[model samples]
Target: MYMLRKFRKVFSLIILTTMMSLGITAPGYAAMLGTDDILAGDNLQQQRDYVKELLNRDEVQNQLADMGVDPLEAEQRVDAMTEQEIQTLSSQLEELPAGASALGLLAFVLVVLLITDLLNLTNVYNI
Candidate 1:
């Protein structure tokens, strides 16, 4: 009877520890960014920069001051944009550019190589 009581005590302690751990971690988990953070962050830098660039143009500086974006923060965010992101800004302003179809291009090239091999078109084709 004593052994059984001891076993039950240990099991209860384990379950209690797990529950405590979860409760302690719950607030940290809640602070995490979700899907909305991801989508919003995607354009965060661009929006910041657009505000600055437009601010630098005629009369927009006063507009930005009215909007409460600190001039330094706006400048910093603009400078922080990566080169690829800057390129995206230009591309986004225009219609999407034409591009090769990845799967189609891969298939087309593979077929052409196979046909060339079957025809023994190159000295490198052994059989």
Candidate 2:
């Protein structure tokens, strides 16, 4: 009978300690279960936010710098781009001709020169 009383005391202490350690707040804890489910809303902002997130990636920014694209200007362009444009940007990044990333800036400059050459807007190397 003495052991039974001690066992009850221990069990009561364990329940008390468990409740205290769980930090049960006095208000509205049970009310949360009664709340209605949330409904979905318009998603345009989500699309814009997702595009903005893509522009923040390391590889896209790195590739921009490699291709002589100014960091700020590229950022501006990205910001100005439509969601459709941003959608295409990731694939376009991969299609950049392979080369040294930093030197890619110089390569971009070279590409511009070639464009002018083809257009006959500039002389070849001798000029």
Candidate 3:
């Protein structure tokens, strides 16, 4: 037991000495952010979240798909975009009408389908 205790003490002392000689510093605790930093972090997070939410809309996803762009790819691209680009997109989304007047768009689609059916381009609905 004495020999085991002595060996343990020696091992601990060696580790301490090696660490001191290597100048190994303990990791620091995080510092608190200033008001400006806090506000900036909040704003950036809000912008990123806003852009993500806009991309999640069914209309936006469908539009991207129609343009031959994968909606998932578009979302990933948004993450790689610059802060200015994100801000611009977010602003544009805010200014645009939600879902771009879903009823109007649906009506237009129905009319186009009807016309195509008449032209025999499509025989949907047997119209």
lDDT of 2 by residue, 1-127 (tens): 9999999999999999999989977675453432233211224345445544644567656765665556565445445555554445434444556754334433443454455457675543333
Candidate 1 local lDDT, 1-127, one digit each (tens): 9999999999999999999888774333446779987876666655555534543653434544554544454455446545554444434433333442322322332343345458665322245
Q: Judged by lDDT, which candidate is best?
A: 3
Task: Judge candidate 2 against the unseen true structure and give its global Cα lDDT, from 0 to 1.
Answer: 0.53
User: lDDT-based ranking, best first?
Assistant: 3, 2, 1
Which candidate leads in TM-score? 3
Off by over 4 Å in 3: 1-19, 22-32, 97-127
Q: Could you tell which candidate, 2 or 3, scores higher by TM-score?
A: 3
TM-score, every prediction: 0.28, 0.31, 0.54
The per-prediction tally of clashing pairs is 0, 2, 0
Computed on alpha carbons, the lDDT of every model, listed in order, comes to 0.50, 0.53, 0.65
Q: How many steric clashes does model 2 contain?
A: 2
lDDT of 1: 0.50
